[model samples]
Target: MTRHPGTNRTAQCVVCGRAFPLPKLRKIGQLRPGLHEMIAAEVADCGAESLICDEDLAHYRRRYVEKLLAEERGELSELDRQVLDSFEKGVSTVQSSAASVLDRNPTFGERTADRVASFGGSWTFILFFMGVLFAWMALNVSGLFAVPFDPYPFILLNLVLSCLAALQAPVIMMSQRRQEEKDRRRAENDYMINLRAELEIRQLHEKIDHQMAHQWERLAELQQIQIDLLERRGDTQRG
Candidate 1:
């Protein structure tokens, strides 16, 4: 109950047992019921009239959110942990650039596979490969080559096509695997951003509700004081 010099009034925090100015203290009653329950679960002696400093209140708010998330999800994943950490730190969960996530300094082989897969899927590669096949057949069948390297059956050409297919399949698969990994990371990032936004909105709603409740209480007190003053005036006039 010791007052800070020059301050009108001060209240001591029940959790931390540190005195703070009235403006810096929050009543347990003003908190949302869920948040109050969280604090009470930790501090057995806390009640509706108990005061908590803003810092302790913030800590309990974070714990309440963490408990809510854990209850809803059961087991927290790495992504969920990251979201909670960011929420506690009051930092943004949004990635600065999504491309940075996709481009995270890929290895030489990965880059090459991606490029090969991309080219192989394009019309340019298809048309060019078709033209090469036609020219090889024309050269062998039209007697353009003195002794055809690949004869009418074109066994050598068949071998080359088979080799190309074998090499291309695995490369495309590797590229696809890398793409799937990138997509998974992007999804995690999106989820974290969305979760952060939702937490912020919930906090905002809690603050508005707290303010409204506090205002109503102040108004009720003022009305009671006015009624008391009017009663005193009536008694005085009657006298």
Candidate 2:
């Protein structure tokens, strides 16, 4: 191929056999160097020394990810399915606020039940109720009323107390049920977040392992090259 004298460095893509600017191509030395040899001749006809375009790189990346998934999880779980889908789509995996999930709009009854439960379980409510009971008994005993509306047995007070207990019990129970639901939702959210984090960490480990292996191979190649050069130098000096 002919090129302008001022044209920047170009690379011949091994897959398409087309020349592109260096910026548009990735060096085999930088990527998985082993991949250059594994590449099918039909798709990429190149020797050991080759470069790949962005399109070919993406294809190989997808293949690598699939291989990892198949090896790690024989049968995909729900979390695994989600992670693989996100990986394929190149989507971000992040955790949203689990605590804030309770912010959903609640019905009037739910709100009222929560408030009533909270108040009924407080010391202020108990103190106020005790004071009212004491005042009622004092008034009846002192004969404050012309006929002491509620006499010694205070049957009216007993009836009022029973009615209050019946109503408060259900309200408190309703509030507790709602709280249990929220806790369950939070637990589910936390589990998803933790599972995703674990998957991402595993993915990172795979990438790092691949990179380290490649680096070791490259270092060995470099060391061999240096040894060959030194031998040649000694030969020349002896002559």
Candidate 3:
């Protein structure tokens, strides 16, 4: 059982098969992912793995856990949502829609990388650079229909092109850097989604095991009761 340090609301976190919230603890839950950005700069002064695990998993199971996590991480699509809604037979239905999202949830980095890559190799970038090069080369070179607006390999033109490239390259690099940052953030969201899913999955497994254990315990208890009843009957008969 994973206990929440310095607390009483023992984690019934059936996911990792741990009980928690014992004492001397703090909980960092009841928060939305939108609020997570502000948290990026907040540092935990001194804490061990157990406390980290407790807080991380607690938020994983709070209200709207699956939906909020999936939506924020860009894992849930409209199509998925439609299918999920249809699965419900009533206005109030079981949480089976995402019952397995966490169980089958993928790693954040992996999923986000796949999505970003799907945008197709920043080819717009390559095309833009190529267009600039071709235009520069053509305007200054003698060729079809062009006596060369600036004459073959114009020195002044080349210098101008060089200057433009120098300026443009840095801007392009800056744009690329910003793009990379976006990818990194998306990847982080995916990771958190994956983490929450894995934790929830572990809890589900724990729930199953707990139920099975209790079933066996209850069987034993009932058997004892039956035996006692039979012995009492026999004693009365003998009496």
Candidate 4:
């Protein structure tokens, strides 16, 4: 509901670059350089970057940073050292917070069972088998409504049915095997995402541990220096 650049403006997602008609989760977005300036310049006498939606911000960030930028650094004013330092600190803090969240987070993979289920359902498969059986029975039975389409006892009908099943079974099996392969691929992608997340978490903890160890080492060094200085002063006074 709240607006940013204009009275009725919707913010584009900094992460995904898609615009929202209504305000979205603000924490997910960041201001890309020149985004506002280009929006202001839109449809002028010259070319300008078009406004985008929040849903697309990530894609834009990945694909169109250069095209949108009017200059090498993306047509933005040079950031002062203080601004840069503050930005870096903010980023580090956000990353640390994300790491903390990820450490405690549980990840469950998106289910690939839907694809497997799509191969066919048990009900449908059974229905198909029932249809085949009913057709065979009707053709063999001599009745007023029945035609001799399959003839008496339906020997030829059974032979044809057997041949059809023999052919179709292998194809259905192939389809199922292909589905299994796709499921394996999906599982692998899930594994990779999980692996990357774990690595990122591990790296964060290692960094924090290293910083703590470094601080301890520095404290120890300072204590040793103080002791040395005190001993030197005492020796001079004694002499």
For each candidate, give its TM-score against the true structure. 0.81, 0.65, 0.41, 0.39
Q: Stretches of candidate 4 above 4 Å error? A: 1-121, 145-147, 224-239
lDDT of 4 at 80: 23
Which model is ahead, 2 or 4, in terms of lDDT?
Answer: 2
Model 2: how far residue 91 lies from native, Å: 4.3
- By lDDT, is 1 or 4 better? 1
- Per-residue lDDT for 12 in model 4? 49
For lDDT, the strongest prediction is 1
Clashes of each: 0, 0, 20, 13
Candidate 1, 70: how far from true, in Å? 3.0
Single out the weakest 10-residue window by summed lDDT for candidate 3: 86-95
> How displaced is residue 112 in candidate 2, in Å?
0.5
Q: How much does candidate 4 score in TM-score?
A: 0.39
**11-97, model 4: which lDDT tens digit per residue?**
543334456654442331123333334433432322222334544433333223334223444553322222223232332212322
CA-lDDT, candidates in order = 0.85, 0.72, 0.50, 0.48
After superposition on all C-alphas, the RMSD of every candidate to the true structure, in Å, is 3.6, 5.7, 17.1, 17.0
Off by over 4 Å in 2: 1-101
Q: Against the true structure, candidate 2 has what lDDT?
A: 0.72
lDDT of 2 by residue, 128-149 (tens): 9999999999999997789998
Q: Which stretches of candidate 3 lie over 4 Å from their true place?
A: 1-150, 234-239
Distance (Å) between predicted and true CA of 174, model 4?
2.7
> Which candidate number has the best TM-score?
1
